[model samples]
Target: MVFTIKKVINNNILCVTDAGGNEMIVTGRGIGFGHKAGQPVNSDAVQKIYHMASMPVQQKLMDLLEQIPYDHFLLTDELVSEIRKKIPYTLNEGLLITLADHISFAIKRKEQGVEFKNPLLESIREYYPEEYRMGKACVQRIQEKLSVDLSKDEAGFIALHIVNAELNTTMSITNDITRFVDGCVKVVESYYGRTFDHESLAFSRLAVHLRFFAQRLFQHEQESDDSMQDQDFRRLIASSCKEHYECAKKIAAYVAETWNQELTEEELLFLTIHLKRINLSSEQTTK
Candidate 1:
């Protein structure tokens, strides 16, 4: 489809409108170098087209394009491509703006020798391993392409941004979920009097479950416990795994007290099963 250039954002980026008059931002090397409004965009020069449905988001991206270096936006675009290939999630288009803004600021901070420590770094690494690995790759790419080396803390920060985009939530909510999961894990550890090995499959499973559990809690969602079979299973778990069931109760209590959200029998049942698995794994590791 032929795109009419609405405005030139930079030498590499242009704001264009299609035949239907839907606005989109297109980017490529020198795509807008000599382009002007009312001209047809060189389709061959368009490397990536960002269609932001929200006008505010589109305007924010345009503002970022004008404020930050185009090269940073290009780097973030490349990273977003990599994330799409690696993760099986439909990320929000807002990632382009959030991540590009972050990278630009990170580079400037590096230049000024100013570094911010990510308080959630460890929890982020443990909770979102895939996204954290992608974040590390992003850091390495930045160093290779821009000659600026960023700390692993920045990788954690970037992972949170990825999580934010994936959940279509704010960064604050994503961080809260991470923190909530970490707190639940600690509660389990405290009750068991030992720490579960982070690399253990059981720990991974528990972490994944808790992450979603926290998300549901934050979103005020609850699982249905109306099924008689589900009730039977919950009873079976409570009987078969008494210790783990008690721990799950503790976690449920903590969630109720902290988040003011009550867990349904389904959540409690799943938590009991995960706790049982973690206990078994811990025993095997010790033996």
Candidate 2:
């Protein structure tokens, strides 16, 4: 199938429309060196073709590729491919462009010796271990392949980006969730007058619960009729575990002040149960 060139981005990349009218970014050595718009692209010379579903994403990739060195794009693609192999979930195709954009900027920052610490690294490491580990490995690969050294904290940023792409969420929302989880931990520690072991299974469970809790809160989902039975059971637990319920209320207050959103009764009940579980485990360890 013949692809008509729509834009000659550079010597290495060409924006083309395939025979089916699908916009694609075709990359090859000297592919666009002597090309012009409306000219037929040399099919034999094409090395990579990115068939994007969204025009905005395609444009974003094109714009990014135009700005950064082609080597950055190549390294970003390799990193994305490695991450996809290690992760269990499927990543969004848009990650191709976003990751490249982030890596290119990071590379420039590294060259200039700028410090870009991810404040949420501790939370990410504790809560999202797999993504965190994958991120570290990715950065190591980046250092080896591109000779750009990034801090371990930068791995946290990359992990969040991966999670954001996987969840089809924005980086802002993912960071907010990280902050929310951190706040929950602070509330628990302050309320109990002690810190729980981050590596504890109970702590991991709490972190997972809080992640989903934050997601539900952000989505502003109302209680469904099917949850009435579960709600009743949780209310029973809340009544029995008054101390835990009080701690849960403090967490809700933190959520309110930080996120400006009130938690539902269902959320409070679930938070109480998770808090109780963590508290009990901590107490047992200290005994």
Candidate 3:
């Protein structure tokens, strides 16, 4: 496919249009160094092609390319590639713009010795372990490539960015989900009168469950009525594990009061089941 250069963004980046007039941003080493509008692009030199369907996102990326050093974009591109490999979801293309902007600002803040703490760091680490691990890798890569060492807090922030991209949601929504999950964990701990070991597999499973639960709450997704088919099992769990079942009730109450979202019977049933497993896991660990 022949690509006509629409604009030269930098020595390595160019805004180009294909034969069908679909605009895209392409990046490569010196791809745009001597290129001009209306010229044919050197396809062999194109290393990355950002075919963002959103015009606003495309424009934002182009503006960012003009503002920040091309190297930052390159670093973020590599990080996004790694993220894709680690995650099961297809990330929004806008991740390139958002993450590149974040890394550029983070580097500048590091240079000025200004560090911001991520309040949701712990929650993010618990809720999005895979993304958090990738975020830590990103921090290490930044240090190796740009000589700027960032804190674990930055890793959390980066993880939230990945979450935002994966869910196609805003950072505020991601923060809300993380905070909600943290609140639910605390509710469970308070009801049990003890903290579950954070590193335990039970806790990991619970965290994963709560993360998606919070997402559903935020999105207002409800379990279908067919979920009631497991009523017999739900009743069995509720009766067999009364204390854990009560703890699950407390969490459900907390969810209702905090988020104003009512949990369905299925949600309550699942929560009770998870709480039962967690309680049993804790019991075995103590014995």
Give the top-scoring candidate (lDDT).
Answer: 1
- Candidate 1: residue 88 Cα off by (Å): 2.2
Per-candidate count of clashing residue pairs (backbone under 3 Å): 0, 0, 0
| Model 2 residue 47 lDDT score | 90
For TM-score, the strongest prediction is: 1
Q: Candidates' lDDT values, in order?
A: 0.89, 0.84, 0.87
Per-residue alpha-carbon lDDT of model 3 for 229-283, expressed as tens digits? 6768778887987887788789889988898888877777788888888888999
Q: Which whole-number lDDT from 0 to 100 does residue 284 have in model 3? A: 99
The residue ranges of model 1 lying beyond 4 angstroms of the native Cα positions read: 225-229
In order of TM-score, best first, we have 1, 3, 2
Q: Write the per-residue lDDT of candidate 2 for residues 168-257, one digit (tens) a residue.
A: 777888888888888888988899898789988888999988886776677675364356458578768878999999998998888888
lDDT per residue for candidate 1 within 1-287, as digits (tens), equals 68999999889889999899999999888989877999997578799888888999999998899999988888888998888888787888899899999999999999999999999999999889989999999999999999999999999999999999887888888988998999899899899998789988999999988887777778777567566356577678899899989999999999888877788777888889899998888889899
Q: Positional deviation of 143 in candidate 1, in angstroms? A: 0.2
Candidate 1 is scored at a TM of: 0.93
C-alpha RMSD (angstroms) for model 1: 1.8
Model 1, CA-based lDDT? 0.89
TM-scores of all candidate predictions against the true structure = 0.93, 0.88, 0.92
